[model samples]
Target: MVIVPILLLLLLPFVGAQWLVCGDSGNYTSNSTYQANLMLLSSTLPNKAVSNTSVFATATVGHAPDIIYALTLCHGDITDASDCESCVAAAFKDAQLSCPYNKEVSTYYDYFMLRFSNHNFLLANSTEDQMKWINLRNTLNFTTGGDSITHLLFMLLNSTAQAAANSSRRFTTSRLGVNIVPTVYCFMQCTPDLTPHDCAACLQVVLKHTLKFLDGAQGGRILGTRCSMRYELYHFYEGVPMLAIPVVNGTTPAPTPATRHNSRKRVLWIIAGVAPLLSILLCVICSVVWTRRRRQGKVNLNDQAATNRPEENELVWRLEEKSSEFTLFDFSEILHATHNFSKENLLGQGGFGPVYKGQLPDGMQIAVKRLASHSGQGFTEFKNEVELIAKLQHNNLVKLLGCCIQGEEKLLVYEYLPNKSLDFFIFERNRTAFIDWNKRRVIIEGIAQGLLYLHKHSWLRIIHRDLKASNILLDQDMNPKISDFGLAKIFSSNDTQGSTKRVVGTYGYMSPEYASEGIYSIKSDVFSFGVLLLEILSGKRNSGFYQYGDFLNLLGYSWQLWEGGTWIELLDASIAKEICTSDARRYINIALMCVQESADDRPTMSDVVAMLNSESGILPEPNHPGYFNLRVSKTHEFFVPCSNNDVTITEEPHGR
Candidate 1:
């Protein structure tokens, strides 16, 4: 009992912090003019010494149509110059990425704001002085997300609002112990000019929004227009005491030992009573379902009209749902299906995202993605994928099941394929032996068909911004299915291309036009396919690629060897071990044709399909591929050895 009590006490703070971290987004874009103002204020403030605080920020430009401004602020407790500067710089980098092109972007980090606008910066601080005026306090609108919690949260915010109104420092903080802890933590601030009542009301509005926008977060806030309110379950502010003014009735809530004790007792009794009953009920139900499973007859539901009715994503279920009528799998069903997402079910990892194998309660299998909380980018990617894949349906595409997003927890459910990704056989040291020439040809053709569906044949034309071997999901018979449409783009029927300042795709596989200038089109995808084809032939990645001899990347190396009639040297030794010489040469020539420098020079998907399916067509000698030979050094032995399109690096030679 003594040890347990001591352990509980020590874990209290850590538990609170962990809860805060899990429910919180590592970075969020600031959306209000008040955020812009706060950004300017923080930027002007000098870094301070270590005290009890920190600071944060981000900048935005161009999208929201606002004036340029900058912001910089430290945690109220910060009193050290060096730490403040360092924290501010760190905060700025994070914000810059989160709000890359928008005119009004801001995000919160551990501490500090590095916000700025291409259009405006607020210069309004009290007393005709700039520096000291900016140091008052840093407050943001905290949204806890919902009615009951929101009301209480706003009430606490009013306390800080009232303090800021009465103080000369334009800073005020209030402690609020609510939800899960016993201590209070809340803050409010302004540009040092607003009245107490104005600050109170302004903060209240900001707090309400914060709760709605970031529900269940232990600590989060909104940067707003006139004033801001911030609250965390944990302590966040630090500084010398400022003149204080209370905002609420003098009465504090009465002690609740009786209520808490009753609640605990009730919870224990309920658990004790419910666990056995629920287990018994579940076992009976399972027994019934299993009995039903054995006697159930297969329903003939294969007609396109009968089973593949075109709901928003109805066709996805057609392929993945077996016979339509998508069944909702219980949490336990998925758990049992995947053997609890076991290591043996593990498929692959990228940017730390792991794919697990699962078997449904009905004996159907699935692939589950248990995303990393630290991979904050995965959240947006998840949302983007859900929106797109749910609407896309085609024979060559992978299927997306319903996703699970509770608080910071995120999961992607997918149709499980028995054969796994194409990269497994192409890239692994010994796996290629299983892939004979005939299977390799089928896999290559399947990928082309999938790309055609995305770029032209499907209901919505999509640009699979990222295309590589690993993303090619394989079925039981080794037929290829395109996966990971997270970065894919949709265009109107007539649209053929789009542009993005922030281009993201696998490096070596990107087209010259897309990589060099951020331009993309169906033709751009063709460029990628050509690179993929070359990699497939050689089982080597073009990006960060290196040969033992003088070669920059796979593309350049292939070109060098082909130009010298030694292209056979570039083939995957495994493929070279058995491929038909004529077919292999034809594929190599076609791949080169697809990678021409000019996007217009590349063949259309129609032509690519025709070429791949052809046997007697006279093929032209191909031109040099676009972005042909960018290369790098590979000193890291543990570096990822990518099979077809898995990016690999080569050592940098001393001379050009």
Candidate 2:
């Protein structure tokens, strides 16, 4: 493995001169205003680019016809800021000379990219008109592992693209190894200004175009104005790669012909000499340990039994002390309040259990969630909700009065709201008209504030892994309150994210990273909030919206409308005329930003709340949403039936 990388490095090709593309948007005379503005931006952007953490900067100089929009992006792995500045500074000078008097130009160097144009290409949604270049080293191809090598290369490229899109710098490098082929190194990046979806899309297009010309080449690169990808048999970029996948054990090289006989003889001789002694030693150790454990087992069991009951009592006492109003209800009292758990008092059925409407002895109405004996969510989730929600207090959050754990039954008691959940109104056609623009706006802001509190201001930082309309309860005044903390996760001050092998979340509301990779953070909740916000605005369920046009979900349909400048078409007909267009657009933009493909790209709950409350300010353009192309067949519709029940998925979904 060490020898392979060294040999490949020695065979690396020489770095070449810059590549340039003069745009078709016309040219400027030597002394024109456009030329002067371009000069001004060129002088300042390199310094700005080097100072920025992403090593990228954008500047617009002058106004109207003379305005020049320029962008400078340095290679992400370049460690020294001065090198980045110098590379960018050199690109500006080269662009003017190479494209001579062109008002619009794109220049690419080995270490940086610089582009300026008369038009705002920064706002472009498509890369069709952008510059594209493909470079291939045709001298070598994989003689061994043929199809496997190709598969590995493409897999590396795809994963690299995803990592780059999710990264704050919009850049990533990866390497993978296989015994039949030399280790492959890949580099991928996009301009920082592009949305995560656009970045991924751009790289996908570049890969498709580049693959047409590769034809088993040992190394190749496809470069474009928005995104770029390169893969070679040697490490090509500076610093450690962001991802590295070593070869499987069986894939490692076997002993050579000359060494095979000697290696086998040496291995056999060692095993023969060591096997009998190891077996005898292991048996002796096991016998002694087993005898000791057997003598202590009864004593340990007695001690554990003595301590267990006290610990359980102490835990219950601590929970009661934490919240003064928390009460442990008697099973008989619960049965009487809900009229023997009658159907008339039944509220709704959830993934974990069924809820019942009950009136306490004091005449205060309450909602009782009875945990189902056979639920996938069991005692752990019930206990989690009891501890978590009891400590959290906010106007938009549902109030947990107490809990009851008696025998085999576990029950949570919450202050009941007469209007049920947001899904009851928003999803049903007949009930949709009841929620006007004002009510929807209030509900959206309320949910944002609730999430903000959970993520930032609460006693414990919480990530509500499953947040959807069904989890949002509406009061008599039609105000929203976030409920259901069964799947919530607590984060300490230093923790920013977490991962799990068992991914759990509603299908349409799950973030791309969480659903596919089992990685989640506060951003996962933000993505769910975005889906709920859109549902409120459009009076539609994301999972059920696939029947419309060719779009697979609400996210894709809304994005297309927003991109085409016809976003008004996405507004619910009930509130279309009642709400101001600007407010509606702002809400839609905020929702889109929340549902961005990359978790890093999604706004924090605080940011979401600020955006929701502010009537003015230019919102950032949202990238295409996560799961924009997730397709479900008619037979598989049962997976996401668009009902109130939130499904907990143990197995990872096939795609996002």
Candidate 3:
């Protein structure tokens, strides 16, 4: 059975009182600089919000270490500027009293919402702070045509959300009427600053949560930091709805006596027609089931001897128990899908093995990663990826469908992405123009959100030791998904870093400490992300970039331009005209910060995401990047090249 995570308060009636959330970003003393900044924001933010046509305002006060970010948003239905200002000012005072000395506070009132924090949550891409309140007083369900009512409710909500996202004000109200139930008055809104895609995504998330608790309730609402929605039986807002859908085909009227008699005869004829067909269908299903089970039994008996090994037995058992959707494919089935692993079907080859594009009998396309017997990665790495990726569920991470383990053959299956990887478009001159500045920005944000999930949000703390352009796959919509987890490492909640004698990863992406001393941490992954970010921005491969004067790699060349205050020259020619100069500079600053020589100087993935989304705050200056001083030469340098292939390097290296 599935369990819905419903809070206990969901069962109680919503009193429309002020709701508050005290954040865990630590507290400040009354007379501290942080408190003073908070006070200044509280005093000015009300006027700022009232002056705006959208009645929404965001402000950042003070400098680093004591900066305060605050935002106030008045409900879309509230038309009076005085009321909006008054609600916001009262929220600031009430929030301080509710959570004394707190550095982060979120206050929700009936007409307005106020939030202040040391962290910039105004544009953060997360729904962790969503709130929901249900109207338990209305315990009525649409007993008449219940299925149709539920379907109508969802349809209304979905359309309303889309309307809100597309509107200039980012707010919309709608009502739908049906013969079998009362009209549902819907309210949907997002902060005007949000992009249409982000607003829709945020609304969808809250809608799922709200529906789980709603269960066809008469009234309910989900309030989130970025977006919100509400539906009630009675009209709750002041003005008329933007959309009003009339009832259509909701329910059929009762039949007359003569029609009832005819209906009975029709039903009898329909039963007679379907009975024979149903019996034959049942027989066919039983025959198919019997044959399949017999074949599976024979295969199981044949494989029993090979599965006797303890390690293999444990691995198979754990995988089967981990997820019911995890399938154990037969070698014959895979062969049929890939047409005997034909050369034409091959997609790419990696350190682990070759990948092929295949279609199953049911017409589902998949990417099959067939592990080569002599590949550097073996059973341990395969097992790690299968177990780890199966548990991670995120939009930006590739989905693992299943695996196959037969004698001398092992394969992993994933959802097929037609656009291939980031490297395919960014590095190719002809394809560089395909991804404009907006698309590139989306890819960057998607990758950052994926890394943030792996590092802090997922059930298991993970570090993708091999993050690069090739490992980032693009879907049909041009969204990025992080793939290739064979080199990932898991850490406990308390563990911050790890070291090993066996250092492994691509050369240009590895952090200095991880490459020279075999010490790896979350920062190691950040370093790789930094290198990938630069490559995306410049449309040049970092491993072989040697055109600049005395510069060995892209990092050194980028530093030269950055130091000279000519960083705009580092951007790809295609996007240089499309992107704002300020945004390009901000992105370069963030990438440089990620590749800092000292791990302590680099920001965490959380901080990186904030910086990427934040448009107002002053970013910290970056130190010199790692490998920034290296020069190209024929002779061996401090670190010698051990392999011709730049895909991966598994050998141990000496300190520089």
| TM-score, every prediction | 0.47, 0.50, 0.51
* Ranking of all candidate structures by their TM-score, best first: 3, 2, 1
Against the true structure, candidate 3 reaches a TM-score of 0.51
Kindly give the stretch of ten consecutive residues in candidate 3 with the minimal lDDT sum: 1-10
Which residues of candidate 1, in runs, are more than 4 Å off?
A: 1-340, 376-380, 631-656
Give the 10-residue window scoring lowest on summed lDDT in candidate 2: 1-10
Give, for candidate 1, the lowest lDDT window spanning 10 residues: 1-10
TM-score computed on alpha carbons, candidate 2:
0.50
Give the runs in model 2 whose Cα sits over 4 Å from its true position.
1-324, 631-647, 650-656
On TM-score, the leading prediction is: 3
Candidate 3 per-residue lDDT, tens place, 1-656, comes to: 11111222434322457777777889999899998898888889999998999999999999979988887788888768899898788888888987999999877776677888887655454333333233232466656766556656766776677778888889888877776787789888888888787677667655555554565577777765667788889998768777566544656678988788788665664453344334534644654564465333333222333334432333334323433456656566788899999999998775578899999999999999998877656655676688788889999999998887654677999999999888888988889889988999999999999999999999978999989888899999999999999888888899899866566787688998887777788999899999999989999877653556557788988999999999999999999999998899999999999999999999999999999999878899999988887866667253333322223474212110
| lDDT per residue as tens, model 2, 551-648 | 67888778888888998988889999999989989999999999999888889998998888789989999988986665446664422233222235
Model 1 per-residue lDDT tens digits across residues 505-596: 77667777676667788888888789888878887766554563455667767777779997778788877868777788889988988888
User: Which candidate would rank higher by lDDT, 1 or 2?
Assistant: 2
lDDT value, candidate 3, whole model? 0.77
